[model samples]
Target chain A: MSTRTVDLVDYDDAVRRYDPVLGIEVHVELGTVTKMFCGAEVEFGGEPNTQVTPVSLGLPGALPVVNRTAVESAIKIGLALNCSIAESCRFARKNYFYPDNPKNFQTSQYDEPIAFDGYLDVELEDGTVFRVEIERAHMEEDAGKNTHVGGAGGRISGAEYSLVDYNRAGIPLVEIVTRPIEGVGERAPEIARAYVKTLRDIFRALDVSEARMERGNVRADVNLSLRATPESPLGTRTETKNVNSFRSVERAVRYEVSRQAALLDAGDAVVQETRHWHEDRGVTSSGRVKSDAEDYRYFPEPDLVPVAPARSWVESLRAAQPELPVERRRRLQGEWGYADAEMRDVVNADAIDIIEATVAAGSSPAGARKWWMGELARRAKSAEVELAELPVTPGQVAQLQGLVDSGRINDKLARQALEGVLAGEGDPEQVVVARGLEVVSDDGPLLEAIDAALAAQPDIAEKIRSGNLGPVGAIIGAVMKATRGQADAGRVRELVIERTSA
Target chain B: MSTISRDEVARVAALARIDLRPDELDRLAGELDVIVDSVAQVSAVATPDVPATSHPLPMTNVYREDVPVPALPVADVLAAAPDAQDGRFAVPQILGEE
Candidate 1:
């Protein structure tokens, strides 16, 4: 690896000089029950090497048979992405000497993919619809996990040794490759992030995979190159691999654009190579260099036959496709009467499901959104947790909203009750009852508090009695303070006016 | 005409992680040339009318149910490895991807 540090051009300056073209390849592991080619169970966090079969272990004389469910999942994903299903596809051997794969070759699709030629329209943060064209989505098998021992940074290099676990081997993977996405200009990073997030939502909607980035269920390989202008030829690009998060995908693209711009500004050429994304350092380091030795020399796998999905089956899968994220977002926005910006904010916060649940639990759409996008969202941010990870549930939020709508608790009292709920006190109702957060409904207690406030501030009371109603706010404030902010200010105002008139 | 060169054979051997002598590299290049020529003859007969076949059988979509079978015991699995550590297969340090 080259240790020379290069200066970076500012992102604005880089975009001013060049146009960035992006090609993203996203890999999603299918949530199948078994290995793609064997009967070994597909699971996470199992004993090391315990989930392997003879086929997964690449033992001699053992053969592999395709898993029906895995193929069905691949078809479902393809249909959701609007890709045309291939009538027949076959696997090929991608030969390498890596110990991650015990077979010394990975079984993957080549030349013939299961799905190809589709496009997805992704909604950016500002609600701009950008269509990302799909090239192909192919089926492949995952490799084993290698834990580098005695290594700095836990990379394969400089490690004393490595331990290999075959538990993840043979898990089914569907790699979706996007065609060269041009004309995005400066929005390349935003489009890249949005595209991956849209696919993740689609995968979950299709129920093909868990689609969790933290669990490595979905990973992105971001390929980016900058041209002199939109009309210029494509420049040499770098492939940054395993950018697992949406934010990381965007960051990797921007970093590459800036880094490449600096190289061009210095009159140096960009090298085409594979680079690894370091999430902590927010920079990409060079991985394997491009060379003849990197060639896979792909050939058809003689052990497995072709997969010819019937036309009827493809149509059936297409018909069974669920409402994808884009359609669902549009539907929800219309049904909730939310403006586009409001809906985008909710989606950005990842609170759509919880808000829907709150509405289903009998809260108004506006009310549910107000709590989730307002108080709860603020609380989640402050607590450094996900909106879903907040201790308060949708039902409790709806209950709190119910209390507010019924005038049993004012907004202030509702906020206190919500705090109690997040603190694990109890449900909203129990929290309100336990914390005595109910608004003052009986006029007798209000009368006593009002009398006490007027007696203490007789001059202000006189001013209110002489027809200056402004000082009546003083009485209400005193009463509210005396009542621990649980009394409704509107009702307090009415009671104070009556007392002053009498 | 030589179908495979000694350097090409050396590169393939390196990719396969095989230690090849110079003389062995030259000898294998000659042997691989014969194999390549024989394979080319088969391709020569394969015209557009005859669809290329990856498998000998005419069948397609051979699949098994997704029900899982139990895995082997850890001791049995580790027994097949040349070296084992921490219930995993241990190997020498990889020279790439830091």
Candidate 2:
């Protein structure tokens, strides 16, 4: 538990000295109705130990059968990643002892995976496309949930006992492993985050998993190793286990790089081990060593036969694939006519869906982007919620933009109407009517305000009468203030010039 | 020929969570060597042309539809456990030492 002794070099200094190599393994829980091998119901937050079958419980004489949809989901994930599907694959038993795994062994794939040899190109913050090659994606079952009682912070260490819930056990999971990503000098951390985000988007696009990082549906195990230089041999690596969020994935890589660099500087070898990420403290601590001693003797499971997906079936799945998230982004960017940086900002903010819906609700692309990225984004940040989770809807935003486009209100008044909508004052139109926030379009009242401004500011109006229009703005400002900012400045200027010239 | 060592036998024993005496490890090492020697005879007869087999019957793609089936009753599920608590299975503390 003591990470105090681990010295860390400065991040920039470490990157300047060492080259980082990263390999990521992501596990996504598929949203199937049943478990991977049994017919037990799969639902989140169910009563403990209730969703279990004899096969899941590893009862004697109970046979296991594979769920068909889980395999299809795995295949879809592979196809989306542009991987070649294996003609045949089998499940192998990974033997271990844990309370979470009721079966003493976890049935996973070894040597033969369902999908392999794929690649995903993720765009970084600056729109630099970094291609991460996919090694394979395999199917496995999840372990049970373990609650450590009488421990400090529910940690496994110093616990008096532990409770196991088998409801989560045996749920279908697709584990995607990336090949060794090399030659990423300083953008290693950003690439790590972007890669995971891309995968999350891909999973949701495929409709296989919920792909929500908050719900533990997607988890990443980040493996980092540092070499002296680009041409040097790979250094001893550390695997950070179960980093559940994108920011944490990026942070874990950065921390490990600095920690390993300090170790090398002091002439100490970086121990190859599984490190646990502490989200609160923003550091990683050593967990267990993965030496040659700890071995999971893997062997094929005899209970289940080989899954030889026919060529025709694979072609059908490939044909039924949806347009991937990356391709969809390109199409949307073209349609919206936004520049590279603008599109990148919209994608990074996760505002693409909302902006699309706002566009569908009859707002122009620039109008939708303006309200969401400028005003709504700031509000969401201050309120500590997601932009989509804000009180205002896409329809309401479009309506507010419509009011601005039709000359009924300026941008300032539109913001006030948005504030009213957020305050639960009803829709944009309702808020506009209730607050009387519409622009003073009637020339009768505008002429009155302009005449009053000209009478009050005679010297400034006198300059406009002498053909010096520089004083026209002063009269317009006065009229806008008199109308409580509901009067349009352009319309006020036109009317002020007419009254002063006459 | 003795192919299995005493240390190897002890390692397998510990993995299976079996506490064996020193004398038993020594005796089992010799006995396991004979078992291996007998199993090695089958490999000698297996030609390169013959492929490996995981199951006897030739079958593939054995699957079940993604349908819900009633799980075993919680009481019945807990009945088989040595200790149960609060609708969960309770066990001694695990330090995650490998």
Which candidate has the top score in TM-score?
1
For candidate 1 chain A, which ten residues in a row score worst on lDDT?
Answer: A288-297
Please state the CAPRI-style docking class of candidate 1: high
Every model's TM-score on chain B: 0.87, 0.91
**Number of clashes in model 2?**
0
List TM-scores for all candidates, in order.
Answer: 0.94, 0.91
CAPRI category for model 2: medium
lDDT by residue (tens digit), candidate 2, A156-197: 888899988889989999999999999888889999999999
Q: What's the lDDT for residue A125 in model 1?
A: 81
